[model samples]
Target: MRISRLRFPVLLAAVSASLTLHAEQTDLRVSPPGWWAGMASPKLQLMVHGPDIAGSTVSVNDSEFVIEQVNSLDSPNYLFIDIDIADISPGDYELTFTKQGKEIYKTIYTFRPRAANSAERQGFTQKDTIYLVTPDRFANGDESNDSVAGFVDKADRQAPGGRHGGDIQGMINHLDYIASTGFTQIWSMPLLENAMDDHSYHGYAITDYYRIDPRYGSNALYRQFSQQADEKGVGVIMDMVLNHIGSNHPWMKDKPAKDWIHHNGEFSATTHRRESLHDPHGVEADQKAFSDGWFVPSMPDLNQQNPYLTNYLIQNAIWWVEYANLSGIRVDTYSYSDKAFLSQWTARLTSEYPNLNIVGEEWTTNPVITAYWQEDSYRADGYDSSLPSVMDFPLQDTLVNALKDEETWGTGLVSLYNLLAGDFIYGDPYNLVIFGDNHDMSRIYTQLDESYALWDMAMTFLLTARGIPQIYYGTEILMANPDTDDHGVIRSDFPGGWKNDSIDAFAQQGLSPKQTKAYNRIKSLLSLRKEHPVVTQGKFTHFAPAEGIYVYFRTDEAGKGAMIILNKNEAENDVQLARFEPVLKEFSTASRWGNSNKISVKNASIEVAPKSASVWLLQ
Candidate 1:
């Protein structure tokens, strides 16, 4: 007879001491591993990390099940077991574990069906506009659960710059507001559990990937949010982080092995040399440093090279996708993980979802480096990737340059002109995700020095240009935080998030005339995008950038074409009729505002006002 310690508290019946003594005690828990919080598979992993849990039989809903792979995961106690389902069928299941034919522990497993592919689901395609919202800062529907037990941080709903009580239910309650804004999809930051004291508000450093943050809501509440989004004709994109975990995560205290984290003991910061990872002639030292470096000592980097760790991370992502019925996934710090592991992760996810979209955050301006990582690019050096979309950092940089750089040959708006000129470098230029600003960077309004016209022009081009578009939260209202550069300040609370607040952007109750105009302009622009597919799926053509007067066309064979004229000059410039003739053939008339009767276009010189952009429909 083998001997084992009976440490856990148990209330056993006095039926047979032999069976109780012979029974195996199984300790099972699953996480996305350190700092890695999202995966794409419709699976949950119960990594048995202590004793011989294999002898402990597993069952789903009291039905017998199979446990594969008795492998160790770098950590001595870890025994990886996968929990999978056929198709994304929604239901509740009872997961029970029995050792020596005696039931010991059981838990509930709830799976939600993935959303059916529709035009709403197509919001992830290269054609739709995405509005990124941080629910905690966006709006607050409940002020009751702001403070919870085990979470050290206190609620400061009054602190404008501090964390307010914005839960998943709050977002769910305002689906109409989001849907009405003409945004087809909402990508919220991580809603996973983060019980850490100081930085729990951001939700990046996740403590539990499977469980929803209590302050945010329960796992069931998240599913309700997803369902609500679908009902409102909007898709949901989960914001995931695969780079690191919080210092207070349970795994940090009871790590399965010593090598589960990179440089756990001899911790050193990474060089953040993103280019070096894809460098053809790069040295091993450079590669290791980039991949192994900790994002911050507080956030521990995961060891993805370990087989168990890799499987755990990948499966966690899938579970959420299927569990929440997510339409797309937006990965945080796309270049921070092991490149080989990322390739495998993307391939598996796309293979499973097929039409599902995954956008990575590779914030680099060099198109070659960004393009090389995209799916189906034939790399000269033989590095393979299956990533579907990448954040268009080059175009974003060029756009900023267009607004700030003085008009010069091969510079300024010409930089933007030249950037689009190289669309041939991309496999599907339309697949790239374009954005002005995100949660990490400074707000776009601050970057443009509070120029409303410049911000509007950038928004127009991003929406009309050939690619998927993502707008940062509060951008529609021209929120700004300059010089300070504090991300918290930039991600300030929404005007009416608190129960007792004055300004209400959600209802448009309190607003200056200019602010209301900005809000209405964005709402109308997004509505236009939803109403017209010519802007989303039409072919893109551009004229040479001349003295800050940049023009582009989105035309299709159905005689539907929209010409966008952006005038950045201080003085209004007379646009030559010749500049419009090449693309506006046969259609000798145009509608300046896309609504009025078509106007004759015979040798007519149009004057484009300074600091404004106009979209005219050609007929």
Candidate 2:
């Protein structure tokens, strides 16, 4: 049986006899400025940053939180304090810092009450349709924040890689549009401060972990956005980079320890080879090169092996979840960090929020490498990762390949079939996140040679497949980067996202006929998937590809079933329904999902249009 850590009654009795004290201080700063009273874990570590602050004695006015330990690191400007808050009540308390028996400074720390049922909050799951957006290019609702005085990057609508001024307010303004498109969750790229000199619009290199980028919006605005999105039935999934930080991050200027960052002396780029973790005969130096090497010259790789740094990252994650009431987190470059640290980090978060979902990005085309990082995976090396989910890059790669290849034996559509057949290696296939394309990859349309039919088929398969589906921004509007795979082009500004744009996708105005059809098709599929539980939660069964045709079925115990057929041939093909008899038994009628085209099961055959997807509801 699991144990409960918090016994509020016992804690309150132990701290009732303490005296309250207050003092004023200007130099000291605490990360996660304040915390709540009723956390699942009683312990909280505050990193105090200031000039020569390590020598000062630290004490809290309330006896509820006893300073268990005070750690002074190599840098005298930083001090780490471990406080026990298991029994504290929601109220204001003063934390005092003193030198030689004289009070130097004190900061007011408040313990707020947790939201009702916050611990049990449900996270994003397969039932959710995640809409991913690069906020800087989505829309601009608040022009006031476009060019904040202190920020280095400014809005430049003409530059594909420059900031386009899309802020949280813009996302807030289009909540109705997002909901109307049937997306239940929104996953924006990193919204935290990425105070780089150029190309900061991407938001990958974070300079500040605690504060939101002022150009994007204030921290309060971000919280408000999440709150409003929750009200609109949309959950917010934060994007976090644990492996590295922007070169300009404050920690780089004054590192608390010598090993706070890897490769502190000279620049060393990572090999980007993720297979070293499971490579039995792999060289120890190669593995270190992958984990310890910097992603680039500008991004400093964090040293999670340091116990203090590990705790800081873990606490920062928990703080955001509690402060913003987030539903989930999407970790960037998950496998590049220390494996042991990754396990502890995930375990801590899951312990606090049992239902919260955290999906890690393990960008590999091999299923074995990706599966090795998932929780409960049986690895021969005896390494256990507490990660709940991983990006389905293996399946993603096959999906695109299957669509682009020519129909042949042991090739083309068969590649996708083979990929799905390998699902047994995963701890939980349903928890994996599958997407057609993302900010880093070429657009789905471009990948499919700009074929609208192939694009439709791809969308249909992603939504009906087993794992959680993520749709990149502008995908529904047929966004394409046909000429190049450059990230700037792939993540170009969405139509009508900026003012004076020729096209507006949000309103469905100024779109071409083909674009309109693609948009409507996505909308129809998303709406249908939302209303049907079988697509999201039912058992997934698939058939082998024959003559460039692949078929799959999702069925629940109650007899509700969905049949999805993908026809890759240029000429129409008649699919023999007998091939799917295992799932079709006892069902007499079938109808196309988006239209009222009746299909007769008695005929024992269905005609599928060339290079098109046909989804039918079986009854």
Clash totals for all candidate models: 8, 0
Instruction: Identify the leading candidate in terms of TM-score.
Output: 2
Give lDDT tens digits, candidate 2, residues 2-68: 1123543444343332323322234568977878878988888889887777778988756776889
lDDT of prediction 2: 0.88
Identify the runs in model 2 with alpha carbons over 4 angstroms from their true place. Answer: 1-25
Model 1 quality (TM-score): 0.88
> Candidate 2: how large is its RMSD?
4.9
Q: State the weakest 10-residue window (summed lDDT) of model 2.
A: 15-24
Candidate 1 wrongly placed segments (more than 4 Å): 1-45, 49-64, 73-77, 82-123, 158-161, 594-597
Work out the TM-score per prediction. Answer: 0.88, 0.95
Winner by lDDT? 2
